[model samples]
Every structure is written in C-alpha cells, then in structure tokens.
Target: MTQPPPPPPNQPPGPPPGDPQGGFGAPQDPPPGGFGAPTPPPQQPYGYPQQQPGQPQYGYPQQQPPTQPQYGYPQQPPTQPQYGYPQQQPPGQPPYGYPTQPQYAQTPPPSGGKKLSAQAQIIIAAVVAVALIVGGGIWYASSGGGEEKNDTAGATSGASQGKGGGNGVGGNGKEKAPANPQAKLAFQLPQPKVQDITDVSGSWLTDKAYVKTGVDSIVGYDLDKGAAAWTLALPGQVCGASRHVTADNKTAVLFEATKRVGPRFYQPCTEVGVIDLTAGKLVWSKSVTGGSAGDTKARFSEVTLSGTTVAAGGTDGGAAFDVANGNPRWSPKPNAQDCYDMGYGGGAGLVAARKCGPYDSQYVVIQNLNPLTGAPVSQFKMPPGVKYASIVSTKPLVVAADVGDTAGDGSGISDFFSIDEKTGKLKAKITADADRYAARCRSTEVESCTKVLVGNGRIYVPTEEHEGSSGEYGDETNEIVSFDLATGKPMTGKADAGDKYTLVPLRMDGGNLIAYKIPPYDKGGQVVSIDGGTMQATTLMENPSDDSVRDAENSFGTDYAEILYGNGRMFISDTMLSKPRASSSTKEYLALAFTTH
Candidate 1:
C-alpha cells in the first residue's frame, strides 16, 4: 500500500488522493485585533461575487459592533481553507470515498438486490483498510495538549446535583440557564499514550462527578477540580456503551473477555455488564450464547438501557439482562422464519430492528418491544430496497434510512419514517436531502447517528455549512431547522448561527434547543439556548478566546465528538484516541470541560 505524505505541521491531514477535501481541523492563529474584536467591514467578502457599496451587507453589520461579539468577526485570509468549509468536487464523482451501494453489517443482501462481485468485495475491503489508516493518521498528526491541570490527587466526593437545580444525567431539559453565563476552563484530561488506535466512547455527568471511560478502565473525576476520584479497572477495552443513563446514574457497556495480544489483535466483544456511575464500579458482568446459529458466545456490537433492562444486539442475535442484578431476562431462540434482532434502540422506549426472510429478499421489520418481556408490541415492515433502518427516537417512533442507495453521501440517511408505535402504521415520510441536512447515522450501527435530534413532536437538524453572507475568507455558517413529526412539513422559524459560526444541535432544554456554535479561527465557541417556538437564541455559556483553549476545543470536531452539556457545564471528548506522531510536540487531551458558574 502506498502511504500519503504527512500533512504540513499544525495542519490536519487531508482526505485520501481521490477523496474530497473537507471536515473540521485544528484551529489556526487568529489575525490582529483577535476574534470577536471590532473591525471595519470589508469592501467585499471572499468567494462570493462583489456588490455595490451602498447595499446592506448580507452577514454581520459593518457599522455597529455586536454587544459582546456573540458571533466572531471576519477572519483573515487562510494559507489553506480552514475547517467547516469543504472544497467543491468536480461533477460525476462520489461525494466521499464510500461506494454508492448501501453497506450491510454481518448480513446478506436482500433477495431482489444485486450482490457485490468477489472483485468488488476486495476493493471495498481495501478502501476500508485505507480509511482506518487515514483516520489514525489524522489523530496522530492533529492532536495537541491543552492547559494543564493537576488530576492525580483528590478525595472522592458523593454524587451531587448540578449548580442550578438539575441532576447531571440526561439533560432532562429542566436545568436552568445562568443569568450571566461566562464560562472558563474548568479542567482537562491528558491523552494517554497508546500503541494502537483505541476506543473510549463513553462519558457521563453526575451532580457529584464526571465519569469517563479510559483505555482499560473507567475513571470518575471531581466535577470542579478534574481529579481522579475513583477508577474501575477492566480486563479488556470497552467495545460499546449506552448513551442513556438511568435516573440513578447507572449505565451499561459491552467489552471483550481478554486484552488484545500480538497475533490476536481482534478480540470478540462478548462480555456484557452494567456500570454504576455514582458508585464507580461494575455491578455485574456476564456473557450469553444462543440463536439459530448456536454460537458458543454472543458477540454484541451495541448495548442500550431501557428502564431496568440492559439490551444488547449483534450479528448472531440479541440478549437482554436485568440492569440491577444482571439476571437473565431473555436470549435469542430459534424462530420459524430465520429472523433475528440485528440491533436495538433504548432510552424513552425499547425498539428492535429485526431482519428476516430469505437471503435474496431479506427485509427489515421494526418492532416496538416490551423491554422486560422481549416481545413485540407492534411491528412495521420496511419497504423493499431499504437495506437497513436506524431508530432515531423510540418514543415517537422515528426511523432513518437511505432508500435505494440514493443518499450517496454515506450518511446512512436519506429519509425519515414517522410511525405510530401503538398501531404500527406509518404516519408520515420526511425526505431529508443528504447534501442539505447535516445529520448522519452509522451504516451498520443502528443507534449510532448524531447531529439530528427529535423532541417536542418535531425533528431538529442543522443545515450543511455553506458560504456565509460576509463574502470574506473562511466565513461559513449554518442554522437549525425543523419538521413536524405528524405531517412531515417544514416548520416556520429557524435558529441562525450568524456569520463565520456553525451551529450544531446538542439537546433539548425544556422548550428551548441547546446548541454549540463552532467559531472561526480567531474566536472561541459558545453554547446557546434557542427558543423552541420563536427560534430566538440566548447565550448560555461563552468560552475563553485564548489560543490554547480554542485549540483544545477545536480538536474535537462536532462530527465525531461526544458533547455533554448539563448543570452549567459542558464537556467535549473524543470517541477514539491514537498514538501521537513521533515528531509532534503539541500536547493532546482525552477530554476538556468548561463551566459557566
């Protein structure tokens, strides 16, 4: 395999040779006057065509400066295109490196669909290998350390409620925003050196501590000081974690039975367990094996929590265990039609994506399941040509899929189907253009989508970042829009990100939408609360504009980053970590926290 040359120093690695150049990168040095500082309007914005001087500028106002620089000022010319703005590709090309066909995981194609030739399969495998290498290289070259903090010595504290009034669990949308929300750097966790790319995707916030998954252990840090309060060592690395946490701060995870050895680089993810976030201990660990294939041990790809049930699903089949005592609830059994549960969605409810029928014409059946019983309450069969379906929300019953391989962007979504879980009937079909909407779902991981959210009977998603009205270099922005779940019609208002700032939907705060604004090179990021009805925005927390802080925040791009905001504090963490480049000097952090108090 031919390796691409390393990117220029401080610059993020670009896409492979035939791939398009895009995605967020490290922050660059701010020009004179600093970001968000007052500046005179330019004669014309870059990229866009020039207009007459008298006409009002399309983006930020040139005459009156913003009250506190809510949105950043125009950035200086970039030696290269900064993050968020992707260069356009020539016509008649794949959007990204992914092939046009819809990829399935551990499953065969539908009866009517064409199968990939042996040669094509090899080509796809090579593409995947190159992608993994490039991905690891990006982290190696782009990672840098942030403001240091003492994290080794501190007394453990009991889980407490967040400052204002809410618990730090699920952002239940009841936490009050501070009146004057000015955030400062709270603490940072230094990245641990690793010999290979490692997965560390889980993080949770509790009133008393912020718990995160480390390489081979889970650590709880004091909320204010960022010191390691307690650590629970594990026998193997965490393979999957549930984003949902119980009311009492209990979550679930899937892991391997043993550590990866020399020739055994890949280990089976067969262990299932529940973690007590408040107590910082693994409550119980176990593994099961069953199903038509009669495998010795079940390897799960995803795990989720619903009420007291810890449900896990994978290629072999599905299993559920009691979250409290790890008692067996149910396991896959031989069925008449050769059906098996591929994955499950849990949080407000428990739903399963079941694949059945013969190999050539296999179709997916979405079932709203009884969490404790593992029985289908109601089921809806997906249309033909739909290879896979992801559950976006279980309560309202929203499923996303790329019908007939038309999404083309590898986002794993082209349309959203709203169904009535009680009746198992389709209510509406929402057509979300892949190029227009920024939401995405992992092709195989049913519950692994981000950037799109469902709440208050509506679906919220951000528009793809486009050229800002400023017409200046690196002035790109986006906004949040919505669609009614019942009718699938466009909603009335929108939350604008302003110029040079990209807005991403984080979660819902009561009737307001909480979002993070990715600023230009010179400015710091901001967390804002947008009114659900009026679409107006309120600044919740603004970060420091210092270079080191900005770099730390920018290191975790919103696309693949895990962001948790609650109790007047925000945490940005990476889902994966890689060995730093031997020649690099910049420090790297596993996670960074900011607080408004």
Candidate 2:
C-alpha cells in the first residue's frame, strides 16, 4: 500500500506530532493584540534581518476584501458585506442594485469545526468609528469602490515596538491613508493545442518554460514570447502511476512505471527519467527496485527531486539517483525504519524519518548532499517537542513543524522554522497561528496546503475562512497571511480576496505574490499580484481570455483551475470548454502567460 503523503521534505506523514486526535476548539480571546485584537507594531523576531529605514512593512489591510467583475462573468454589484469590509461596487459595473445573482454553496467547515476569531466586538467598534469619521459618505472610484478609507484599521494604535519606518496602522479605529494605485491587466496569451495542462515551471536563468501537456508531451516555451521552443515525449509503457515530476532550467525529471514480463505473473518496475531541455532528448532513464532481489515487483510509492538528486521510496524502503545520469547512488536496507516515507527536500537534498532509539524515538533527518554524489555533507533535527512537519528548502533550510495544541483551532499549531545549512544549527522559528492541517482540510476532505512559499525575504500562508457572520453567497474569505521571512511573525495586515474573486496563491514573482482567482462557480479565473510588502493586491487580468471555458471537473467533482509560475513568468490555462468545440484550433486548452517583471 502507498504510504500517506509525506509532510514537506523533513516532515512526517501523520496528524501533527503533538496531539493527533485533538480537535481545534473555538478561538479564545487573542493575547493582547493576538489574532483579532489591535496591538503594537511587530518587533522583528530573533534572527530576523534588520529592515532598512525606508523598507516597506509587509502586512494585510484590516479592511474586508473586495469583489471584481471578471471576463464573461457579468459585472454584478456585491449585495452582502465582505468578511471585514462593507459591500462596495466593482469598477466598470453599473451602480449597485442591478440584479441579485443566485448565492453559491458555502464551503463546508472542517469536519471538526472551525474557530472564528473572537474579535467581532472589536471589528464592530472599528467599523462604527470609521462610519462616523467619513460622515457616512459614499466614496466612489472608476477602478472599483473607493479606496478603503479605514484600510489601516487598528494598525497604528499599538506603540512602536522598535525603531521602524512609520506609525503602525491606526489601532484605535483611526483610518490609515490608501496606498499604491489600482492594479491593471499587463497582458494575456492563449493555448489552443493543449488537451490538458499537467505541469508548468519557469526558469529565470534560461528564460525558458517547461510545461506538461495532457497528451504525454513536455514542451519548452520561450519566456519573452508565448511560443513553444521544443517538445519531448515519454517513450515506452510505464506500469505504475506517479505525479512527482519537476523541472529546472536545464532538465526535467519524470516518474513512470513499466511492467516486466514473466512466465507466470508480470512484475512491475519503477523508472525515473531525465529530459535535457537544451538537447531536446531523453538523456537518461533508470529502473528502481528497492526491496529484496527475490521480490520481483519492487516499486516505489513516492518520488521527488532536489537539485540533481531524485529520491523514490516505498513502504519497505527508499533509494536515490542522480538525475543527470540514471545511475543508482543509494538505497535503504529492507524494512529499515530510516527509509520510511523518504522525500526530496525540494531544492534541498535527501530527507528521511529516522528512528534513533529502541522504541518511540524517531527524529526527522535532513541530509544536504553534494547532489553530484549521494554523500551527506551535514544533518540536523528540530528542537525537542517539535516534530518534523514539512520543508520548503535547504539553504537556510526552511521547515514547518507541529508544535502541539494551541488554545484556538484545536487542530494544533505548526511552526515554520529555518536551520543553518552550513552548521545544521537552528536559526529562526515562526509559529503558524493557523494550523496547516486545519488549512488543508475541510470536513473529512484533505487537500495539500504545504505549498507555502517564500519571496522577497518574506513567508506567505494562504487562508480560506468564512468571512462575515452572515451566510450570504459572497462573504466567504480567501486570502493570504504573510509573515516576516526571518522572524516568522504574522505581518501587520493581510491580502484580501476580492469580493467577486476567490484567489489562491501560486508562487512569488520577484518580490510580488502571484495568485489565481476563481469566480464563484464560474469557468475562467484571473491572475493577480499582491505587493510583497504592503499586502496590497492588483488584478493582472480579469478574464485572461475572451473565449468561454467552463472549469474542468474531476470524477470527484472538484474543479480544476491550473495556474503555475516558472521561468520568470506566470503560466495559466483554462479548463476544456464545457460545450463541444467547433475545431481543435479553438483556444479551449490554451495557456495565458504574462511576464512578472
């Protein structure tokens, strides 16, 4: 049987390490200025680099998120109040009261329940104060509703923690001034030959793109112009199915399985191949058989690539290979506990969960290797009580841990910490107030939320929660929570999801954050950017393409909205058109790409 999805590279596969069965309870009153309360400006945590005097503070505005009109999605006035902001009009749309659209279904809460922050009273007071200050005037703008007058709600009242740039956003319900101009679409492209989009990655160094098409082909595209440069195909029949494919500027690694014919029963074989993009050829392919020689069908359950190391693991054990040449480098002993749930540490090398002592003693081990050779250069473990949860990278190696149960969100809290790559020493630690577990799961359904990314020296977390108390159609929350990359403290404010938008962060472009926004039950999605520092957002494109395309649905009825960032550009594609297409040349399966810079 396949092992449960391993937590990020250094993390294990299980409910958080501290308390597996605990239920996250209702949110408690935040400490001083915790979750909902207004507090002093954040003091840079230990190990955080000092900010320059003129550096911008990265935080989300306290005002509720707004909505927008998307391509094909008719412009509709928002009737219900957004999570933290009052209802407002979108740009280019007629004045409010056009016609009310049917409400979409509510996103079910986690099966164990959810904790709405207990800051409702404080929010009400702030809102009332803003209404009074504005004299209850209706401010309008061509871009959308007027800039949120109370955008800085509760940001500045707290005493300055240390020598910093400006007064924090007003804390005592005072309104802070608006920021950067509204966002506009930069550009959009179309992809017609795409049957389905499997993957998309960009390489800034080469200014090239690697994309997996629905039909067994990987194409390289030019970064400047949206054109295919080269295409590679997976040859031969593969037995097992795996989704652990990755690409850098120079090479792409794909995982597949093949069947070995036998006189009695056919046995399965695992294969990992590397495609040299520049040469436009399958450079190398290797078979993986980690278990005993007698066992004919030794297959891997997991596959991942870090640097040049491709690691594959099964319940029995795991192994590593050099992606440049399909040569075996190392394999774990049969049934060895250390080999269980092995994973590639993203750009970091090999990662494994090792049992150190006799029983009940297991430590997550990270091995930074030369990649050229499977030899470890160094290793480290998290401080005690901290269980390995997930990892992002190795240099200044980033990892998240399940620290234990916190007062609120009984699912327990996770800490994203960094380790010194040179010495394997602890460098910094930031506590994730919102549990990754709680964030990834809804009711009994579990989704991957470990895609947390770092950009422009800041860490970001995506959160989706019920916005206002009203169960209205459009008040649900979907935005990103940012933290100091060094300190791991939640930034002063957060990025808001637009009223007509349900944006999910894809990756970071330079210092800016890139995300895909899906309209409520709509076919197409939009590309938007959030200022890395201020958490302000701009819609790069509304519809992205003019052609109508219904979102694709899996057997599970889950909608597929594909948006990827790589090679210094954002790769976006639409699902197949819901209705029959007139011809294949139609842009039903095209990718709309834009240069982030």
Candidate 3:
C-alpha cells in the first residue's frame, strides 16, 4: 500500500493523522452536554471504520452500504396471530402498503475468479442461515406474525386405545376399534324429503325417525319406499302431540285442548282420547280434572300404560291415572322425586320423582309398583349427597359417592347400594372405587336398562368426571364407566362417541342402546347407533330432512324426539306448524328404516 503525506511538524494532525475520509471517531474531551451530547453528523456511511493513530492501514476497498430496495422482503406469517392486523400493501391506490417482496442478487463470478469450492460453500451456507433466522425474529417482533404460519391446523395427531382390564360388552358386543384412522367418513348424508318441520317430537319405533302423509305431515314422502307416502287429513289442523300411537301400535291417544294456540288446549283437565292406529278411530276419550281459573292446580301432561292401568304425570309434579275399566289406579305426589337424570320412567309404576331444596338437599321418591297391576307397592326414598341411583323393575339401587371431605375433595370414595324393594331400606353396600378402579361408574346418571342388562356380568353407566368438584381431581372427559353388575367395580375401557350432547335417556334392546342425533335445522346432522357390548359405533341414518330448531315452539324437553324399539317397524313423526289452517304449513315425515323380517 502507498502512504499518504504526513501532517507537517507545526499543528496537531486532523483526525489523528491516519483517519479514513470524513471519519469522526477521534479521541476528544467530553462535551459540556455530559451524556446527551449531539451525535456527530453521520460520517461517510459507505466507508469503513477509521484506524486509530499508530494502527497500520490495510489495502481494502471501501464498501458502500447497499441501497434499500423500492420493494422489501416478505416475511413469513406467525403460527398463531396474537392480534388480528390488516396486511400491509406497497405504495399504491390503497392507503396502506402490502408487504414488499424482498429481492437478492445472484452472486456474480468474482472478477477473474472461478466458482468457490465445497468447503467455502459450506461456510457461506451457515452464515446465510444465521442471517435469515435473525431477520425473521426481527420481522416477527415488528409485524406480529411469526415465521410458522406456513402450516396451520392439526399441529399434532395421536392415537387412543381402549385401556383398563376387562372389556365387557358395551351397548355393543365386545370388540376393539382402530385408532386415529386415516380414512374418509364412511359416506355422505342423503338429501331426503325436505320437510320444513314446525314441531318434531315422536319416537323412532326402531332405528328410523320419520313421519308420512298430511299437509306438513307424512304426506309428500312415503317412508316405506324411501319416497313420498300417503296423506291423511280430516278437517282442522292436527298437532304432533294431538294424537300418538302406542309402542304396541295398538292405539293413538290425542291430547285435547287446554288453551287455544291455533289448536285450543283442553284446560284444567284435558281428555286422553285413544284412537286405534290400525283403525284410525277415536275409541275412547277420557278427560282428567283440571284446575279452575283461580287455582294453581295441576293436571295430566301425558299418559303411559303402566301395566294395564295408565300411569301419567301432571304438569305440576304428580302421577295418577285411570285404568282401562275407568278406575283410578296409581296417584302421583311430590317427593319431590328425580330420576337421577335417567329415563322418563314415569307413566307406568316406574315414575322416579324428586323433591329438591337448597344446599344440595333433596328427597328422592321412586314409586315401586306391582308391574302386573300398575299400582304402587312401595315408595323408595333417598336423601341428599346420594351421588347416583337407579332402579330395575321394582328393585332399586342407589349409588352415592362417599368421596367428599371438609375441604370438598373426595378420596374417590365410591359405593353401590341396594335398597329393599318393599321397604326402601339399605340391603347391601359394595365398594366401587380404588386406585385405577375400572368398576366404579363415575356417572351422575344412568340410562337404558333391561332384565338381562341388569343380570349381565357388568352394567355400564355413562359417567363423567365430578365437574366443578372440590375434592380429589379426576378427568372430566365423558366416558362409559362400567361396573360389575354383581360386584360393582370398573369393568371396561370406555370409548368416546366423538361428540358431546345432553345426557338423554336411551331406549334399550337387550344390551343394545338405541339413540338418535337430530339436525338443528340450519345445518345437516345425523342419527347414530352405539353398541354397548361390542363398543362399536355406527351411523344408522343421517336425516338431512328433519330440522329440530326450525320448529322451536314444539321443542322443549329432552324427549323432543323419541326413539323406541319394539316389534319391528319404527313410526316417526315429521311435523311443521300442525295448526292455523289457512296460512303456511310446516311439515315432518315418518320413515321405516327397514322392513320387519
């Protein structure tokens, strides 16, 4: 390198005599402005750092700062945005600039040099990666979206298998299923007869839930052929509950008026008129007593055949009824009783009633009956903190979780109890919960039951974790916790049905539980079948046709739609605006899922 001329021996050399051009890095005394002194004007931005006095200068070219592009680089968006922000646009007709696309020039061959070798290439690659990472972090800090936005949704996938020791029969026969399947849903829902329902609350006799014939009735589509069926109409509008057939398919009972909402409700007392579904004739009309306008009285809501006598519940909490021969059989009184959120076991001699009070206090009353005579033989009773209980036939069993302490946490204390059938006294108590206990049914409710279902080696209760619990913690996930029907312990590895819904009562067939899922009107939905024994799940039907929420007026209770399994054919109710003759007619349909073999 050639040397520049030195400063003469007269004055101090400017910039210590060896500074780069326009350099300001010089040793000097502190200014009067202590720390916040004005920074010296930017020196040669395109120049290298100046050398201090006595330091040798090397023959290096001054590197000019790269010009910022008219457009900049696009940074990757974040995995999840903390705050929603509008994307930036470039200078244009729009107010904000979209992010600029950054550009990098291809490395041109060095003057008179060949391409770099492999080792040199590796070093450059590492440096480039580090720079990109640092740049991405800076961009994320300023712009909010991080670099992981490239992949969204399903960040993790896993498999779940049936665990625990004994895999007893679920509502399905015992069988294990594939986990995390990589297949499509079996099939698509069929677009059936578009029945814009106004009210839909009729049970599925079998696996099918549809109605046929009448304007807004089962008229347009015939369930038998999967098409339109016959329509039957007399005169004024009829309601879904106006008349219903029995599970035996013997008679249809119509709910007469109590007040007029298009159809005048038979009030104070309404008549239970029975019309033979086979003959379609009004066989008999029996009117129960109703309260006078000035009284806060109760009356029958519906009637169910207990044995030969009709067992019924009142609008206000009571069960009483007249037999076929015009005799008052069993009467309902408030306990107030509860069904442990179980089946609407009322109607016959199985009415479970509850009288509830504050501080989790309750008096449960279940009417045990002469299943042969439809008369109450004895009333079963229970006190509060009785976690769960159920009845089979006239014999009732109560399940109370003895797990709570002063701190409200439980030791997972569980026990099963049998109450005397005739006296409602404790008969036998068995322990159910233990470390990793499989027999303890953690449910607060019990659903379907059968004679054989009760006698089987195990009985399954749909259990959920003690929610909002104060004691020992348990998984709050929904599970089918089975207990040995004989000994009462955990029995099987449960399965999740892939959906959550209100715990509704299920109709039972042997060990099989029959239930249906309905569409909420606005969207498509399905009906599912769960095998309690095999632990298998199947979608029997997806009726894109029925919409529950569309007809809000007629839908209130969990029994909004019914699923009953009996001698073969299923009779479903498809109803819409079953009233106000001259105007709009909402409709429903009944379909037979399969022919009776």
Candidate 4:
C-alpha cells in the first residue's frame, strides 16, 4: 500500500495524467523558497543517494543532515491552506495535504525495483494523504481485553488468539518483556492548531489511560505522566472510532451532529456513541431515523464492538445499539435487494460489508451476523470485480479484495479470502502481491486494514520496504511474512526489518508477534517481540534516538500513524491534522509516548 516514489532522474514532468490537483504528478504549490528554505539537494541528503567518491555509507550513525526542512510537507502556495480527506472532494483535486513536489524523478528501479527513500517519498506522500482522507475500520482485538472465541475455521488457541481475528474486547494486554527495553520520551501531544484536515482518528490502550481522539473530545492520557487523564466532551467531529474495545473498557464512536456551519461543512455522521474506556465517560449517545435510506438520519461511516453489539455502518444503512443502554439493537430496515449495511467487522464475531446490486452491478455480501440478531448467520457472495470487501478476520473468515482493479496499489488489497464461517465455505485464497505486499485495505473502508496480521493459522505480512544488503548507500529493509491460513502456502518464517528498519505488524501477542520498528534517520523506534514460532525478534521497547526524539519519531509516519505498543509503553498518534507549515518551524505532534519501565 505504499508506492509513489518513482520520478527522480532529471525530474520535473509531473501533472498531466488526470492532474486534478496533482498527487503523484507532484506540484500543488510550495516550491520557489516557500517551504521555509528549500536549497538542500546539491550534494547528498534529501532522500540520500550519490556517494561514489569513496563509497562506504552503511547504516545509522551518520547524523548531520538537518540544516532546515525539519520534517515533511511544507513549501506551500496555491493560496496555501489545503489539508485533506474530510470526504467529498473529487472536482479538480487539491485537498489532501503535503506532497507539492520537492524534486523527485530518480526513476530507474523497475526491473528489480527498490530505490524509494527521501524518507520513502515523504512516507508515500503521507500515505497518499491518508489513503485519501481516512476510510474506516481497523480495530483488531485481543491484546487481552479478552473475549477469546475463534472457530469458524480460524481455529483459535495461540493462547486464545485476537489481533485481527477478534473477541479479546478492548484488547492489547501482553506486556512483560522489559529486561533492558530502553525507551524514554514518555509523553508528547501538541499538534492541534487545525482548521481544516482534522479527524484525529483514535487510539486506545487502557489499564490506566492513553485514549486520544480529540477534535471534539476523547482525551484520556496519563499512563505514565502524559497527563490529561480524561476528557470525552463531544458535540460534533469525531466522525467514527471503535476498534472494538469492551472487555469492560467499552468503546464505540462516530459523531458530528453539529459544529461546522459555514455552509454546513460536513456534519452528519449522525452520532452513535459508547466510550467508557475505563470510565473516561460518554456511555451512550444515539441517532437513528429509519434506514433503507428513509427518514434520513443514519449517516455513520463505521463503528464496531461485538458481543454487546453497538455496530453502526453507513451509506444510510446498518444500525444496532445496546452496548449496555443505547438500546435499539437493530435498525436500518427497508431492504429488498437494495442491501445496505456497507461496513462492520467487530471483534470476535458480527461481520457484514453488505452493499448488494444496482450501482452498475455492484456486489459485496459477506455477512455472518447475529451479534444479537442482525440476522444472516453466514453468507459470502463477493466475486465479480468486487468493488470492495475488507473484513480481514471475523473468526478466521478473512476477506480483503481489489481483485479486478488489480491492486493498482491504492491497496484495498488484491486478494485474501479464507472463508468458512460454518459453511460459507471457500477457505484459502491468499495471492497478495501488491508489489510484494505491505498489506492495506481501505479502498472503501470495510474495516480499513494496515500491514495485515490474522494470527496463528497464519497470515502476517510486511515485505515492501526493500533495498538493503547494506552499502552502496544501503539501508531500507522490511520483512514479516507468514501466509498459510490453512494452505495458501509460504510460511516457514521471516520477521527481519533490521538494516534501516521498518517492520510494522502490531497485534497478536499470545503466540507472540507485536512489532513496530520504523527507525532510521539516525535511529530510535522499535518494539519487537515476534517468535510466533521462532521468527525471533524480542526487543520490546527501544524509542529515543534523541535529536528532539528523532524529530518526534520522524513525525509519526508509518503510513498515517497511530501505533500503540503495550505495557512497557509506546504510543505515537496523528490520524491527520494539518495547518502548521507556513514554511517550517518544525515542531508538530498530536500524540507520542514511550516508556520501558
């Protein structure tokens, strides 16, 4: 799901192929001395490469490269104010923030491909402006919030799995690795000056707090002194959250009922609430009107939490409530082949992704519901061009798609079936290869997806950062590999990420496999643990390459960040929040944490 870095050899040619405000075609403003100082590319170090005099540049330890451009996306001016993905833009582009071309065009790596780095094309233009303004779903459970139910073929029992396979409710719990861990920085959050591109996404981690989701409140912090400790506020603006908490820490969101006004700048995610992350509050909020596209209200874009239900979904459909007292339990009724649900994949059970016929033969069915009778106890149906799917794991029932679109790399995934929720059958498909995998899946957000990971019966995945046998200007690395959800093959072991680092996997910690790593640019991030069998990694916490904490951990770029290691800490946030680069003063952050104690 990363892709964009190819243009570098003589550069300057972008913006023609459908240049509706240019994305890969570069240029959208900020060049001629505006990014607050753009003269650093004469000899070596914007994205590094050009050292033949005596060669020899191996790994880490080479500091000295920051005379100005502190972190990314500055150099502005097309009137300058863009910030992206609030949803609904398509008319001549120009919205999703940062990527105004600061020289790229190195080209040359196609017959074997690998080159990429100017910090990976500024982290693939901030993950293509957060895959075009965040789509939805990405909760994966069982860090130990506990629900442990696996079996429609996921075959549970890797100490009771739950990280992308579900049911360990507000999950994330296996800490214990400490010995030498190393961490430091412990708290940082500042980056709120936003007036546009906002949606602070979400982030959790309980057993004392860490919450986050601010632009209309959720706060929480204080796990080891980051402070705040509780906020919850809300009246509008947290348009969706719910990576399924609830082993008591409860969880569910999706807001916006008012608050934007100037021509009503988007304010209809309806409402649907549930918070309570160990008492940080919210408890209940509701909004449903009718569904089947009728009384109007509905709106949601995604929300989950199984067992006690909650649900939510959108395109004007799917409802469900009762996380303890919001009550409804099911709504959105009208059906008759118009089929609407469109999103849902809560932990441990309850799947959905419906979207049936009509808009030009559109398909997508995948049911398996019954989280208190939303009905369909098993379905399937996707095939035929598949406009979208992405479930990733409803008890081994995985899904992900992009099929006929052939994963042109916007990463809705290019395949990963594995069904069998009792009898929906199928079981093993796999096929990844979106330029050698780095899993993604938000094409339309049926539970979003990222670096993928379904547990023990195997799925893992990582691979895409390439180029690293160490010198010639070496160091880029990446590797996790696993696949074998019953027999889609390849799985003898992998884990790597060493050289300049990049790993990412972040879940499943019973049979082991936690991962995070990123580092490089003078080093610091890590979290390791691997060994789901002997993939062997183990570091646990690391963080702190000093230089103001590696420039705030390289400005949270692991594809639109949010990361969240457990116990021995690690947090990192930012799901989009623009408005600081009037030509760089650097200093930006919305979340950060690290610990090791």
For residues 73-177, could you state the per-residue lDDT of candidate 2 as single tens digits? Answer: 001111111122211211122211111110111111224445434465345435543432232122111112111111000000001122212132211211112
* Candidate 1: regions farther than 4 A off: 1-173, 292-295
Query: Worst lDDT window (10 residues) for model 2?
Result: 149-158
Each candidate's TM vs. the true structure? 0.71, 0.52, 0.41, 0.31
Ten-residue stretch with the least lDDT total in model 3: 23-32
Better of 1 and 2 by TM-score: 1
Candidate 1 residue-wise lDDT, 462-574, digit = tens: 87787778789899887777666675645545678999999887765544567889989988899887666556687888888899999989988787778877778888888
**Candidate 2, residue 355: CA error in Å?**
6.1
lDDT (10s digit) by residue, model 4, range 1-597: 111122233322232221011000000111121111111212221111111111111111111111221211111101111111111122232211101112111112224445555665545445543332322111111111100421111111123342432222112335567878888987788888766777878787876887889887888888888889678788878977866566667778888877765543567788888888777888789898865657778788888777687788877778877788997756776544566777887776777887765789766767666566455544556556778787876776788888678668787776677776644545555556566667787778787676776766677778677776665464878677665565454444466777888888766666566778888888798887776655667787888787888888887787777677777887888888865778898888888888987
Best by TM-score: 1
For candidate 3, write residues 1-597 as lDDT tens digits.
Answer: 111121232232122111111100000000111011111222321111111111111111111111111111111111110111111111222111111111111122235546566666445434543443344344434432110000000000011112322244434222122232111121111223322323322222212223332332223233345453324332222332311233433222324343233233223334444333333344454543322211334344434433343444433433333334434433332221221212113221233433333336443344343433333333334423454343332223333333221112232224444444443333433333222222222122221121112213444444322222233333222333334433233333343333322122133333443333333334333333355555445544333333442243123222222333233322333323333344545433332332232
Worst 10 residues of 4 by lDDT: 19-28
Lowest lDDT block of 10, candidate 1: 148-157
Compare candidates 1 and 3 on lDDT and give the better one: 1
> Comparing candidate 1 with candidate 4, which one achieves the higher TM-score?
1
Q: Give the Å error, residue 202, model 3.
A: 3.3
Backbone steric clashes in candidate 1, count:
13
